[model samples]
Target chain A: MSLDAATKPHEQLAEYLATDMEAVNRMIRARMASEHAPRIPEVTAHLVEAGGKRLRPMLTLAAARLCGYDGPYHVHLASTVEFIHTATLLHDDVVDESDQRRGRPTANLLWDNTSSVLVGDYLFARSFQLMVETGSLRVLDILANAAATIAEGEVLQLTAARNLETTEEIYLKVVRGKTAALFSAATEVGGVIAGADEAVVKALFDYGDALGISFQIVDDLLDYAGTEATGKDIGDDFREGKLTLPVIRAVAAADPSEREFWTRTFGKGRIAEGDLETALALFAKYDTLEATRRDAVLWADRAKAALDAVPEHDLRQMLADLADYVVARLR
Target chain B: MSLDAATKPHEQLAEYLATDMEAVNRMIRARMASEHAPRIPEVTAHLVEAGGKRLRPMLTLAAARLCGYDGPYHVHLASTVEFIHTATLLHDDVVDESDQRRGRPTANLLWDNTSSVLVGDYLFARSFQLMVETGSLRVLDILANAAATIAEGEVLQLTAARNLETTEEIYLKVVRGKTAALFSAATEVGGVIAGADEAVVKALFDYGDALGISFQIVDDLLDYAGTEATGKDIGDDFREGKLTLPVIRAVAAADPSEREFWTRTFGKGRIAEGDLETALALFAKYDTLEATRRDAVLWADRAKAALDAVPEHDLRQMLADLADYVVARLR
Candidate 1:
């Protein structure tokens, strides 16, 4: 439980919130069981038990604890956040036709799409039930809005995929919808449940929002940079014709032949061998990856700055480090 | 609008609650819209406005009105109910790989499975938002549990599909989860939002549960009986190897040779061209379809009897008739 600097910031946060994290895991296991449908737990267990960082739930716990609140409902809120995250991953794999997730076969691959869809739904309902147990109307409202934003961002991403017309503004909106919305909600609900003041809650929300944006941008950059840590094949997003920030920027600066290259590969979904190399080459040519990297760093800085309003605590320092760690992955 | 016996009871209820129903429709249209993701409304509108009977939402409206509680939030509740239904239908079509819904091309078919899945999630989130606006934690709890049941039933059905050993009890569980859960929740939440007594809420729950069971049973019967009124091709469920009530009973009464037939067609999913006719012949031989019809009638009767606990109102009488009318399709 020592604060080892060599270890990841998330690992440090996990150590700091070790007791609450255990409670959250226990609640997740207890609630995921079904009286009649064994398949519900089977699909759920595959993803939930997979060695995820458990980063989102820890945000909830850290936010609540940092606000000087000592309550049992923080565990419930953390479990609720994790359930929502797991449910989305199950559905995302199905929508993306992904074969692998968290370095293991996806639920859709291990089980059928039907099980994944239905089981994801079961988890969503479970999450709703958990939040309702808190009896906080404000928490329900925040999480409900977060759910809508996440779904809307996903749909927007689907429609915006491979379109050369996608702008950076749209990319930010998509990022907020798909990633930041939940992050912000996860942190905001924790503060709300702890009865934190408006200023402190707003600070928590800002921190989460900036951190999530940085996290996603770094993820998008790594898709081209080829990182083994993410367990994603390099340029998988390119193969899928997803218009992430780097590609959107590269397309923005493309010349005639480059535009056609972008159109043939991304817009028309006619990716061929070495398309990844060509995409990377274009990124290098336009320095779009660097620009994207700068964007991630800027967001990370903002996340750290947001914590200045919060009371000084060990968790607060680790959270600021967490934002840095997210962008530091690009190094 | 007159409660003409010649007219269907749902239609009568629709006419009786026209004003409220219109408001529900307007709210559905408004809430389904997305400024960023036009695809959300497109996929949603295809199914939402495709001339559905709006039976689920109408049940909510009728139940609230019958409870003698006048409130603006009932419109919101009815819309919430429909959004949940539409969202499930979108995902169900994707899970079933269905081409047609409400006798038109499914959204999954027109768009891709991705659109269907994401748009369905959007609708579910939208439904959650609508319910939160009602600010009734009791209603949220009822709907949350119902959501869990619906999802659990679907998972149970997915696991039990094509299994010859799936008993009547298991079949009932599947039916309750996939169909009756929503139906009961619709009525129960209506009574709950009206602040009705526990007895009245329980009665509403009972009425909805029985009506949904009978409705599903009759629908299964028509899959064998081939009624154009239901907008489903006879033997569709058989072709899909679904273990509906008729198939479950037929298998229970099946002899050795009949069991082998059931095993090959259903269990192994080796359905051939003549299998539908053979299955129908077996159903006739054992009078299993007749038995299923009797079960449907019994459930319809139970639904009508449950109405006796409620006050004598016109909506109550119409609800009773609605129960009978569900089974009337079989005749």
Candidate 2:
């Protein structure tokens, strides 16, 4: 996990996307400023300056490069994808009533819920403007679909917050809607507007979809393993009654005692102390965490297969590395 | 102000819009519903079904018709305008932390702030999708610009909240961004997409802009003078310390002691229970309310003049009447 190695995949991604995403970051910080709204700079900067991997925007840039795009609009497209991602995160924090994001206080917790809502809106509007500047109706189409999917996912998460009957299929759909759809959209549109042929564009889209699926599955896997390194507390999902992939599998495979335990914990939505240990024990008993890790690797393999349709290039290899990087956490 | 023979103009305009806006209303309610996100249907229905005049959509519908549009896309365009408006209101009530809207419990108070933000996002995303379906880049430009203006206005309002030194010009900018830009965009895009000449489209835009200015000024006016007619409390704006058109003008025109009272009340965000009366008396003493009313009428007159570029038609006449209806509250 250390950054000392020069040949590390994350480092390779950093070196690959660094030059362009630096520009993307600069644009984000510049556009986020407001003459009238001083709080805008503070709240947006808190999240923007936070150490995210920039994987989504990097996917966009990589996709466009793979499609042989030589246009400068890809930078804006990259920045736009990031804005959509950032805006969703801000609103997600508000909707989830989350205080900690990346181990720092959330915008809503630091400011008020009103600032979070309005600032999220400002970012959304800014994304729209950035997309329009690209002058690519196809890209707009793709991103607009992603935005709807993201909103739908957030709403679905709200309704399913305390519900225990949320199925594996439903969970997958929600995860796709919330995370993978945007990942795919960010990549697919880049290939699309670059005039890539139908095969390559669709391949990029599928690759992004699978990469995102793997990315999120690994995240859910980490949530169960107690070794979750994503800064968020491992037990938050259980505490909040969120049934991710591991929990869904565990519930499906539960014994009588396990069923009653889940009913008392997730269904009732109030877990006493050490319920985390009990849930972790159940996960171990059902081998759900290991199974979830295998699922992540399966998605990563499918994602790599998706890229077989495209010609090999440095950027393309980097994308393949990213797919591998998604499942690297499972190790 | 009574809905009698003397107010035939308002009645005529209402019937005119009611008849023409049928398609717009149908599309809006249908499109607002989502199969996956039931919260959208729930929260949207709370506000969409809340009885209110559909003036903004009417402006859009009339603009397209008066410019001799023969296409069906205007129906979608009008719905786009309303969707954006409703979406903002959903968010605005949450930001304002209001308890009631249109005599019913606000969505935030009823459901939660989370639902308000998510549902507002749902509608906004839905609105963008609907506009994208229209396939007119010009229309997208118009609506997207309006979205930016609306967000800017919201941010400005947030920054200006409880600050009393905000000038009349700043108030106008906030109101223009918050209200007028969408109103103007709704109409302008209609004419633009209808293949109206630039001059005619500009006229429609001007008419809508003036009408919106008049509409908002009259709304501020009603905060002081309206009874059961406007349905909202008469002095909520005063109580909220919103430095609207009347208050901004009055503050500029106040004497030294009155200025000190105004500064202490608004600048410090502190007020006694009867401070509303004191503010009202100050507004009266400076004739700020009456001056603002006159400004609304002047804009109404400008609205009528802008439509002169379009040829005489029943829809054009109704649009002019609608402009008058927006200013009818001043009487």
Give the number of the best model, judged by TM-score.
Answer: 1
Q: Taking the tens digit of each residue's C-alpha lDDT, what string does model 2 give over B83-171?
A: 88888988887777731234347788788877888888888888888877877767777788788778878778767866877987788
Off by over 4 Å in 1: A1-4, A98-104, B1-4, B98-104
Listed per model in order, the count of residue pairs whose N, CA or C atoms clash below 3 Å is 0, 1
Assign candidate 2 its CAPRI class.
medium
Give TM-scores of the second chain, every candidate.
0.95, 0.93
Writing each residue's lDDT as its tens digit, candidate 1 over A208-269 gives 99999999999888888856876677877887788998899889899999999999999998
True contacts kept of 1: 0.81
Question: For model 1 chain A, where is the 10-residue window of minimal lDDT?
Answer: A97-106
Deviation in angstroms for B157 in model 2? 1.0
Q: Runs in model 2 with CA error above 4 Å?
A: A1-5, A98-104, A226-229, B1-14, B17-20, B98-104
Instruction: Tell me how far the alpha carbon of residue A14 in candidate 1 is from the true structure, in angstroms, after superposition.
Output: 0.6
Q: Tens digits of per-residue lDDT for model 2 on A216-250?
A: 88877777664635655677778777778888888
CAPRI grade of model 1: medium
